[model samples]
Target: MRSRRVLFAVHDWGLGHATRCLVLIRALVERGDEVTVLMAPSPGLQLLKAELGQQCTFYPYPDIPKPLGRSPPMFYAAMTGALPLIWARFKREHRLTERLVRKHRFERVITDSRLGVWSRTAPSYCIFHSLRQIVPGRSPAIERLVERGQRRLLKPYRKVLIPDFAENGGLSGDLGHDPQLDWGAGRLVYIGPLSGVRRQNVPEDIDYFFSLSGLEPQRSLLEQRVQAALPRLSGRIVVARGRLDAAGDQEQKGNATIYGYLDRHAQAEMLNRARLVFTRSGYTTLMELAELGKRALLVPTPGQSEQEYLAQFHHERGHAWSTTQRRLDIVRDLARAQGTTGIPQHATADSVQRFLDAIS
Candidate 1:
């Protein structure tokens, strides 16, 4: 195979995008491709730097302002209000992408949910899981409208690679699977779950593994709530705060061991050893849980419709127990989650190869 110069753009909305991209970027490097990552200044970027080291080039780029609100209604309103600004950012991103493509002579451009990071001169592709954005009300009309809009935004890419199985409705369920949407046959590909974490043969010593992550005040809020309830719970607990800036510091509080962050290897080991996993319902996290077949208590972030939908979907299916952040009772939920079945393990060993083959 010829060594190609590839430019990968990642969305800084959360660490999930960066982590999943890391899997593909590593595969590209292993195959002798020169890869460059374009991203905003974020913890996600820091994590990539720490993991990849000198393996790839890193470019700093500005990202659109995150649309966040304290409540679900406010969040939707904020997204609606930020449309113009988001559009401007998209234009800016495209301009930067074009300049980078010309200057670096990139042979391929792949974006992970960054709508504006594609180049006309290169063979561009997009990695996206959500084909239809579910709203707070689950209105069919609203969902269809949003799906149409998303399809239009994805029209410029040569292919939209979905990191999910083609059969059994996949992990994403209705979020990525919609019979109504027309994606121009052969342009949409299901490449299975692109997770960096894998199950390992290790003793299940950790009673509860809290992998806390997300943006801003909500992350802090969840931490505070968990801290308040920690004294009431018993057993060997491990909490990864998901703070990349902490530089991997560890602290001990009673029976629980807390870390500011856990790199890929450490996190994978913890997941394998944990008898019960407690974390968010983000798609990426769900994929990891599915890969490891770990039972979990899911707490969805406030105002995040997608997470809310996913949590409910899993709970109804008896895959994982879920609750809102405001109503979190760690002790009670943990007990309840133990009785439910965990996510089923799926074959993801060839997911990265499938992606590479599709692009090639």
Candidate 2:
């Protein structure tokens, strides 16, 4: 087969979207295909660039505004208010993708939860895990409507690639495969967990690793909390602050070594050395931990029902321990989180090859 030009549009929700996109992006580049990435300026995209180097072309693109608020109700309210902007964003990106497609002659367009970046001339695939949008409260009617809309919006793509198993034994739990959603046949493909971290035989040395990520004021708030508790904590802990824009600086603060950001290899190396990891319960983070077989303390972001549900799911399944950011006491929670089982290795090299085959 001839080498094809591929366009990858990533959603800058968190670093997870870009991190997951790396697996496929690297695969395309390794196969001698021209891969161009369109993403907003964020830590995740920065990490992607550092990882890929000159293998792919990077372009800045517009991103959807995150619905952030102090509480779940407030987040929902903000999201409702931003519906017009969201609509306009979709239209804007749709037009942008059309222009890019015409200029670059992209043979395939793969989007990581970007609903608008698709072209009729090229085969387009959307990478998504959430089929049903979770609201703060239990509102079945609203959830059904949201799910219907999600299905409708994704129908234009050639296929929807889920980073979870089609069977019930998936990492995404009910979000990817619930009984309520009607995902049409052949339109959905389970590509398994897309993670850039590969398990190594390196020895474990670091006692605790704190991976700080997600949107902020919460990100900053969590950093403050962890900083306060760091002096009391007894361990050789390394904290990756998840600040991509900042200088790659490391500082010693009592028993903790804090880094503004870690490149992919460094992050993987730290994960390998860590006996216990502390981070958000994002699906990509879960995949990374699972790949390394490392235990973690999951602190779900407030008001984000998806992360909350995922934390709860893993906690109940003995995969990982979880707590909300408000109730999190670093020293106390570490003891509780240490006793739980970590995520198991479910994804393999075959999964990656299968994903490449399907996309090709």
Alpha carbon lDDT of each predicted model:
0.89, 0.85
Number of residue pairs clashing in candidate 2, backbone atoms closer than 3 angstroms, sequence gap of 3 or more or interchain: 0
Worst 10 residues of 1 by lDDT: 172-181
Candidate 1 clashing pairs, residues 3+ apart or interchain? 164-192
At residue 246, candidate 1 shows an lDDT of 88
How many residue pairs clash per model?
A: 1, 0
Put down candidate 2 lDDT per residue, 1-360, tens digits, no spaces: 789999999998887888788888887888889999999987778878888899999988879888888777887789889999998998899899989999999999999988889998899999889888776575898888888999988988988888887775588887888737777878788878877788778878889999998777788889998989888989799999988766579899887899998877888899989999999998888888878877889998887888999999889988888999999989998989889888877664656786787888
Alpha carbon lDDT at 341, candidate 1: 88
- Which portions of model 1 miss their true places by more than 4 Å? 245-249
Off by over 4 Å in 2: none
Instruction: Give the per-residue lDDT digits (tens) of candidate 1, residues 1-360.
Output: 999999999998888888888989999999999999999998789889999999999998988888877777787798889999999999999999999999999999999999999988899999999999878777899889989999999999999999987776678888888646789989989998978887787899999999888777788889998888888889999999988778569989999999998887898899999999999999999888888888999999888888998899889989999999988888999999999889877756688988998889
